[model samples]
Target: MLNTSRRLWNQFFRKARKVNNEPLNKVSLIVLIVVDIFILINVVMGLDDISRWYISPSQAEPCYSQWQNYRTKTTTDKDFEIIKNSFFGIDNPLSQEQIYQQVEERHLGKVSQTCFQYAKYQEQINIPPNQQIIQNIEQKQIQVSQFEQSNSNIRAQYDSTLLEKIAGQSREKSINVVGAEKAKQELDQNNQRISTLKQEITNLKNQLVTKPESMNFLGFLQEDSNFNQVEVNYQQASFWYPSIQLGFQSLFLVPLILVALSIHNFAQRREYGLIALISWHLLVIFFLPLILKIFEFLQVGVLFRFTFDILSTLLGGLLFLISYVYILLIPIVGFGIIQLCQKVILNTKAQAVRRIQDSRCIQCAKKIRTHDTYCPHCGYYQYIECPNCHNLTYKYLSHCHQCGAFQESSHNHA
Candidate 1:
């Protein structure tokens, strides 16, 4: 039953995919970019809407391979280093030694001479706003329905008694009906208030959830040491903005998305194809972090903290705009380009669909990849094969373009 259900589901999805011709539509891409940009701006402005979209704030597992990852913390590191240097310059030798010991112990073999950050551990929210609200709404609605149902059941028994007391008298029946109607009206009014209150409560809860202090950024630190580190605790009995959390997560997500997109676009295309994709990603992820850190580093040199802030803000805008154009828009346009090449230029779909297993480049059998169209190394064409008879087939094949085979096969004379 499970397999059968899965097969049906897959069939439906495959058909849907074919009809769409791409994973995401232009409208979807535009919406994602618009929403992402809006959220990015909100995050920059300290609006606190970071994890609103599907992307959630993870523990920000830094990919050790990317230098950009380190740059992100560069500013914070500089702050610590400056504080450290100042301590040493003031002849506070013990404090500097303690700080170094803490760093060496905590970052041992992973981060050398890096200041420990006591950032709050945050996770991105996955529940849709509607889902979150609707869940509460649904519970209340169910309660309302249940109350009415139970009330009706009780009223049915009361009506029996009332009818008995009326004793077939028209006047008594009329009086009883009027009284019941009045009672029901009062009950309904109260119920409505309760329902309204439930809705209001849900909204308030959501509001609180989205507030800046809802998620603390202090718990993300390597908890081995606590004393003498930056005590960036969540205050107000708790604090830190969801917008920042989500927005930062979104910033992380965009590059991840772009990387995934490029991988899907050019994964099988070539060995060197990702050089461009990764390079762009590094600029956003690693370079942006690096530059911001540099500003932090030179904050002492230039004696201008605001300079770093301005540079970081400008960098954020530049990143968003570039992401919209290159990371976001490029994929939508690139999908069109792929389709155009397959239809107008080559009269065939991308060669990437042909890769079967082991990362073999479908187009030229050069490099391994997942979802690209052409062989980047040799520029070879990739083709789908008829599953039934093992003959090469076109993407839109109703029958095997090579041997007139359908996806399904029937017994035939060999």
Candidate 2:
């Protein structure tokens, strides 16, 4: 069994080495390798793009982090300030009362907008009552938006009028008294309009909360049902995303590998060197990404998550110890694999057996006569006396060829 396995490995290496037998073929192989690397990079990138089609946790629930902070009672005034500034793009420093008001307003607006979206999503899936609730929220939101826009316009006009009034007063000694008086009247009217708009906007916002359907939607957001479901779905999608990407990448490469393998096998049978070389390159290109993605999946997919959960549960505060454990364990594991390969898989005895079977010196692999006891090239012993048969047999072979007696020393060496 070992001899058969060794023969297959030797044949594979022999064919691979033959692929670049000539100088021109070597250059062609290098060019094909460069092409393969380029294709592999692009294939990996394409897989990444496909994986992003699923919604991420942050995208699915934009306010989740803030909501969590709020729920945990860890939201400080600094957090509210940051949120308020971000929402309104505020650059100027605000007074304490102004900061509080702006933060409260921003929070309400965000909640309302999120709830409206949730309602719309539910309505799209034909959920009863959500359609009516969505329509009501949309109407109220539009009204609030329009009022806010008008209020901004009115404030801009009031500021202009007030500035004009101050200029007119400054020029009162040189200009007409009538123009100064008119500027003052315009400023007063603008101020009154600004006050009225502020009242109207406040009234509209209050009315938005008063509506039954809108109130219910707001209540839903407050209760965390909508956000919780989205969070759960986002987590589930994230957990499976790596596996999905690996599956898709495999699907893409598997067919190419199969085709290339078939071509390679056919070419080898027919002694079509060039065809076999190209097919071998194609097979390697197709398999490289698959092997890389499998490793990637093992690191980041559900398997990793499961392993992480177990470690977290077991180690708790001692989780950092895992790094030290891996640092010590990996070298030991690698050393064991190396020892196994040296002792059993690719041992020197296995190579000697193949060389002996081909009538070559076991030490130098140079041509030798069947009855030669020592290699002429290397002066290494080619045969040893088998105790059971008292006959010379090839060194490193498990059994004596003449008497079919087991060579104990040869078996030990193997």
lDDT of 1 by residue, 83-182 (tens): 1222122233354335544444543122222232221111122124423543565577677677677566556655654565567555455534434455
TM-score of 2: 0.49
| lDDT of each candidate versus the true structure | 0.41, 0.59
Pairs that collide in candidate 2 are none
Candidate 2 achieves a global lDDT of 0.59
Alpha carbon lDDT at 2, candidate 1: 53
Candidate 1: which stretches are off by over 4 Å? 1-240, 252-390, 394-399, 403-414
For every model shown, what is its TM-score relative to the native structure? 0.19, 0.49
Query: What would you estimate as the lDDT of candidate 1?
Result: 0.41
Best by lDDT: 2
